[model samples]
Target: MAQYSGFKQLLIYAVSMFIIALSFYQWDMSQRKQEERIHETQELRKQPLRETCAGDKETFKHRLEDVRNNELANLIVDDKHGIIYCYIPKVACTNWKRVMFSLTKDEPYPDPASISPDLVHLPNILPFLNSFPRSEIKAKLKHYTKFLYVRDPFVRLFSAYRNKFQEHNEYFYQRYGRHILRLYANQPDPPQSLKEANASGMRVSFQNFIQYLLDPLTERNEPFDPHWRQMQRLCLPCLIKYDFVGHQETLQQDASQLLKILMLQDNIQFPPSYENMTTPAFLLDWFSAVPLEDRRKLYELYEQDFRMFGYKRPRELLDG
Candidate 1:
C-alpha cells in the first residue's frame, strides 16, 4: 500500500512538471511570432522609401542647388551613425534633437529623455551639416541615412500658433506678436493691449494670426519662421533622398522602425511622446476659429506642401 501511494505521488509530480514545460514552450513560440510580425511590419513601412531612393540620383543632384542658407544649416549630422536629420520646428524637433545629441555625443547618455529641450538646441551641442565643407556635406547627403518628420501643413501651423502665440512665450509675443499687432491690429502703440494680453494670459486669436501670416511684407522682410515654413522648402525632400520619411501622425511606429533600421534599438529608444495635438477634435476646434477666406488663403499658401507630402486638405476645414 505504501509503495502504491508513493508511485501515485511521483506520477502526479511528473505530470505537473510536464504541463509547466509545455506552457513555457507555447509562450516562447508566441513571443517569437510577435517579434516576427513586428519585424515584417517594420520592413513593409520602409520598403517604399527604399524604392524611392533607388532611381533618383540625377534628380537629387539637380535639386541640391535650392538647399542654400538655412536649409543647409538645419541638418544635424551624426557621423558615427552616418545619419543626417533635418530638424523642422513644431514637428517634434526638440525630442529629435535630444535623440541626435544622444547618438553623437562622445559619451552617449543612457536616457535621452533626461536631456532638457533647452540643452538640445544649444548652438555647439550638435554640429550642423553646413558647418562642414561643401564637399563633405555632399558626400554625407549622398550616403547618410537622411530623415525628417513632417506634419500636416494646417495642423503644423496651428501647433506653431499654440506654442508661440497661445502660450506664454515671451520671446515670440515680443518679436512676432508685437509685429503682428502693429501690422494687423491697426494700432500704432499696441503695448497697452500687449500688456493686457500678457497679464490676462489670453491666446492670440486664429483670425488675427492668419492676418499676420498672409501679409506679403512678412515674408519680404524675413523668411517665415521654420515653425510654419513649408516642409518642402525646409527639408528639400525633392533634392535629398531621405532613407526614411516619418510623419508626426504615425510618429511612434515610424520612429521605432527607424531606430531598428539604425540598429539603435538596444542603445536608445525614442522618447515617450507627451502630446498628441493632431486629433480630429483638436483640429476642428482650432479651424472653427479661422474664417473661411483666411482658411482658403492658408490652404493656397501651403498648396505645395500638401502636394509634396501627399496630404489631403482636411474636410473639416473645407466644410467649416
Candidate 2:
C-alpha cells in the first residue's frame, strides 16, 4: 500500500495510480478502436462505394457498446496479454516463478536468462514499450500485468554467482562476452561496460560479480578499478529496491495480491508450499565462506530492505 496522509491525499494518490494504470491499459483497446474507425471511415470515404449484397441494408448489425458483441468477432487482443517476470538473480525469485508460471506447459518459466538481444534493456522489455507506437503495449497493457522478483543484492548476487556460473555452463558470461568460465571463490570488480567486461573476459555471473566486489585483490596482477564506487560496491537489496520495489520476504503475500489484481487466480495457483527449495538457507553458506567484514558490509547494504519488509538479517547470528 502507498503511504498517504490526509483523506484528500489518499484519494488523489489513488486516482493518479488508477489513471496511470488506465491510460497505459487502454492502449490496446484504443488502437483496436482506431483501426475499426479507420475502416469505417474508409467505407464512408467512398460514399457511393460499391454495392454489396444489400448496400448498407446488408442485414448486418453491430452493438458497439458491448464487448460480448464485438469480442467473439476477434476484435480484441485478449490472448496477447502478458506479464514480465524480470528475474533478478537469486533471492527467492525462483519461488515466485514457480507460483506464477510453473505447471503451464514448457519448463523454466520466467527465465531472466531469456533476456534477449532485442529485450536487453527495460525500455525494450516489451515491444513498443519505449513510449511511441504505444498501441501494441498500450492495447494489451490491461491484459498484461508485469511481475518482477527481486532479492537482497548481496544474497542474490552470491547465489547468481553459484547457480548461474559455477553450476551451469559459462553461457551467460558468454552473453556478456567472457571467454573463460571462472575459478572457485574468485570475485572480481563489477565491469564498467559490457564492452569493457567482454574486452577483458570479466563478464562473469552475478555471483561472480559479487565475489569481485568483496574481494578487492581479484586478478590482483592487474589494476582493476571500475570507477564508480557504488558500481564496485553494488549490493543485492539495493539493486532490487531500484526497480518496482517488491518484497522477497513477503513474496507470497505480495505475489498473491498481484495475482488477485490481475485476475489470474484460475490460470495460476498460489502454492501452499512455496518454501520448498533445492538448497538450504543462504545464511549457512555466508557464515562458512564469506568473512565477517564482508558479511557486515552486506548487512549494512541490505539493512533498509530488511527493515522495510520485516526481516532480521543474519548478522547477529553470524556475529555470535
Candidate 3:
C-alpha cells in the first residue's frame, strides 16, 4: 500500500514496466489470432474452434481487432492519483495501458518501463504472479490504491482456451507436443475434455495443462509447475492482497466506478465505450464454445472466482 487512497495515485506511481511488458506482448498478439493452425501438433487439438457468428470470420475478426486495438486502449480513466493496476492476463490490458499513459495531470515521465522497476520494487519481468507474490505487499499500500481486475471465470477460461492461450501460446504448443488441441482437421484428440485427455502442465504441449492439473497429486509425490492446479494455488494466496477488485464481465460499469474511486468521475463513464460493441449473441457464443463436461471442470476449478465476484451462473452458459 503506497498511501494515496486514490486510483490516480496508484496508476501514476505503479510499476509501469509491467504494463509495458503487457503492451509489448500485445503487439505480437494481433497476428496470432489471424494465423492458421495448419502447422499444429496433436495436443493442440484439445480445444475446439471458437463459436463465431455462424462462421462470420470477417465480422468476428474485425470486432475482436476493434476491441484489442482501440476499445481496450481507450478505456483508460485517470484516478488523478498514483495507481497500481495488477493486470490479469487477457483482461483488456491494452486499453488500460493506453489509459494509464494518458494521465496528463501529474503524470510520470513519458516512458513507463523505465520507472516501473522502482515503483514495484522488482528487478525483472513479473514471470508469473506466483513467484513475485502480491499478499506480502498490500500492507505497504497505505500510501497508494492497490487494485486489480478480475473477469467472469467462464468467460475468461473460454477466451483463453478458445484463443490458444493468448499470452501463453508458444508455451502451450512447445511443451505439450501431441497432447494440446489445434484446429487441424486431422488432430488426434481434437478439442476433447480435460478429464478425457488428462491435460495440465504449462509446457508447450497439451500434456502441460494436464500435468498442471495433476500437480496437486504430484505435490504429495512431486511438485506442480506450468500447471493450473499449481499456478492457481500459487496465485490464490496472492489475491488476498488486492484491495480493489473489478470484474471483466461488467468492464464498462466496473471501470467507470474505478475511475470515480480515483476521483475521475467527470472524466469517465460506467461501461467505457467499445466502438464495435459486441452483441449479446457473441457473448453467448463465447460461452457456448466450451464442451459441457470440460466446462463443469472449469467451473468447479474456478468456483472461488465465480462465487467471489457475484457472477450468476447462466444455465445456458454452463450447459452450452
Candidate 4:
C-alpha cells in the first residue's frame, strides 16, 4: 500500500510540472503576438506619411538644405539618448519640454513634473538641432529617432485664437492680436496694450483670426506664426523622416510607446495631459461665424498637413 502511494505522488508531480511549462509557453506566444500587432499598427501610420511626402512635389523638397534654420529650430535634440523631438505649439509642448528636460539629466532622471514648465522654454535651457553644425545636424538626423505630435488643423487654429486672443497675452497682443483686431475686428484703433485691451473688452474674434489666415497679405509679408503654423511647415516632415508620428488625439498611448522605443520607459514617464477644451465636436460651433468660402480657403492652406499627418479632412466644416 505504501509503495502504491509513493508512485501516485510521483505521477502527480510530473503532471503539475507539465502544466506549468505549458502555461509559460502560452504566455510567451501571447506576448509575441501582441508585439507583432503593435508593429503592424505603427507601419500603417508611417507608410502613408512617407507616401504623402513622396507624392507632394510642390511642398516637399526632399532635401535638408532647402529647409531654413528657423524651421529646424523647432527640433529639440537629445544627444545622450539619441532622440530628436519636433515640438508644435498648443500640442502639449509644455509637458513635452519638461520630459526632454528630464532626459538631459544623469541616471535616475528626475520626475518630469518636477521641472518648471517656463524654465524649459527659456533660451539655451535645452539644445536645439539648429544650434548644431551642418555636419552634426546631418549625423543626428541619420542616426537619431525623430518624432513629432500633430493636432487637427482647425482645432489647433481655434485653440491658438482662444489662448492668444481671449486670454491676456501681452506679446501675442502686441505682435498679432493688435493687427488682427484692427483688420478683422473692425477696431481700427484697438488698444495699444494687452491690459488696456482687457480693461476695454477689446479682443480679436475667432472669425477675425480666420480672416487673417485667409488674407493674401498674411503670407506675402511673412510666414505664419509658429503657434498657428502648419505642422508640415514647422516639422519639415518631408525633409526629415520621423520614426514616430503622434497625434494629440492619441497623445498618451503614442507618448508611452515612444518612451518604450527609446528604452526610457523604465527611467522616465510622460506627464499626464490636461483635458483639451477644443475638440472636433466644437469645430462646427466655432466655424459658424466663419464664411464657407473662407473655411474652404483655410482648408486649402493646411491641406498638406491634413494629408501628411493622416487626419481626416474636416468635411463637416468644409461641406457647408
Best by lDDT: 4
User: lDDT of each structure?
Assistant: 0.78, 0.42, 0.43, 0.87
TM agreement with the true structure for every prediction: 0.79, 0.39, 0.44, 0.93
Candidate 4: how many backbone clashes? 0
Better of 3 and 4 by lDDT: 4
Tens-place lDDT per residue, model 1, 135-235, is: 89889889898888888888888888888887767788777887777677665655645557767554457777888889888889998888888776787
Which of 2 and 4 is ahead in TM-score?
4
**Residue-wise lDDT of candidate 3 within 62-100, one digit each (tens)?**
322133221121112223455555555546554555455
Residue lDDT tens for model 2, 1-320: 24545777979999999999999889979867865754453344222212221243322222222212211211112233355343443444344444433433344333333323233323322332323233553444334544444444344544445554444334454543142223432434444444555556554543345445555464364432212122212222221122123446556665555565555655665544345242335446544555667667656644544443334566553474
* Residue 99 CA displacement from its true place in model 4, Å: 0.9
Tens digits of per-residue lDDT, candidate 4, 222-310, equal 98899898888888887888888888888898888888788888999999987776766777988988899999999999998888777
| TM-score for predicted model 2 compared with the true structure | 0.39
Task: Name the runs in model 2 displaced over 4 angstroms.
Answer: 1-87, 91-125, 131-147, 152-155, 172-210, 215-254, 267-282, 307-309, 317-320
Q: Candidate 4, TM-score vs. the true structure?
A: 0.93
Which is the winner by TM-score between candidate 3 and candidate 4? 4
Q: Alpha-carbon error at 169 in model 4, in Å?
A: 0.9
lDDT of 3 at 109: 25
